[model samples]
Target: MPSPVGHALGGAIAAVLIAPRGTPTGSGSRLMALRARLSHPLVRLGALAGCLPDADFLWGRHNMETHSVGAALAAALVAGLALRSRRAALVTGLAWLTHVAFDWLGSDDTPPLGVMALWPFDDRFVFAHAYLFEAISRRYWLPNFVTHNAWAVTSEVLMLAPILAVLVWWRQRGAGPRV
Candidate 1:
């Protein structure tokens, strides 16, 4: 499956698009302001939520029930009830959905082919093999970090960084914090 870069970038995109944003303290560049804004607790929470569904891998389960739409709905419902804000639930849910969408659109050359996106409802593994994303390197951390994974992640960054830059810049220029 696609690695953390795609997932994290997806979360960052969600944060930029949905989270309340304002100018940051200090005479920092817009990029710096973006970094600061992304550090906000709510933005970070959204970013974290993007990768949270992968936690099912902890028990040797990669993409079964947790990768389903049901899981996203359950997350949104729980987050809405716990956070007492529909906006929070929406951001959290969108962040998670971004991950699933990326995974669904990614190229998965590994066995089992794709994620069980409709698990518990439809047990089929779904894959687009669109190559919009790069597959993770199944090597040791250091080696992978310097090689296939690095290139893959760089591709993700190259694809996303400009969009993120434009989004942040537009948000800063157009208005104050949005709901």
Candidate 2:
């Protein structure tokens, strides 16, 4: 499964694409606009949501209940009620689901491999077996731990940076206007 870094990037991307936008104001250079979007509370919340499913680790259940559509919907409902914005709710829920997506596409080295993505409706675990992202290691004492994780993080950055750049460019070119 992807690390928090990758998951956060995915969530931020979802937020940028789906969250409702305010009217563009001031100097609308790409950098400024991108900065503004990145700094929005919704983006930050999305990033948080992206990493939220990992909280299952605290209970020694990393890919169980929290990594499910049910959890995503609950998160959306709570965010919607709290923010009073349907767009925010949708963005937040999708952002949370991005965690599940990353995990589904990643390599899983643990037992009962894959995530319980459809929980509440079904308890079956699922995985794409795509291996698009590397599995993260919790074994700090392993010889290649640091090196492996570093490479994993680098790979994630390389994969995600281009997409983020394109999205920012599209927004700047008015192809994706703030809505």
Specify the highest-TM-score model's number. 2
Q: Please, what are the lDDT tens digits per residue for candidate 1 over residues 92-115? A: 788788877888887776668767
Candidate 2 lDDT, 8-52, residue by residue in tens: 999888877765544246647766777776777777888888889
Q: Which pairs clash in model 1?
A: none
lDDT of each: 0.75, 0.86
Root-mean-square deviation per candidate: 3.1, 1.9
Model 2 residue runs over 4 Å out of place are: 21-23, 176-179
| Weakest 10 consecutive residues of candidate 2 by summed lDDT | 18-27
Candidate 1, residue 176: the lDDT equals 41
lDDT of 2 at 126: 97
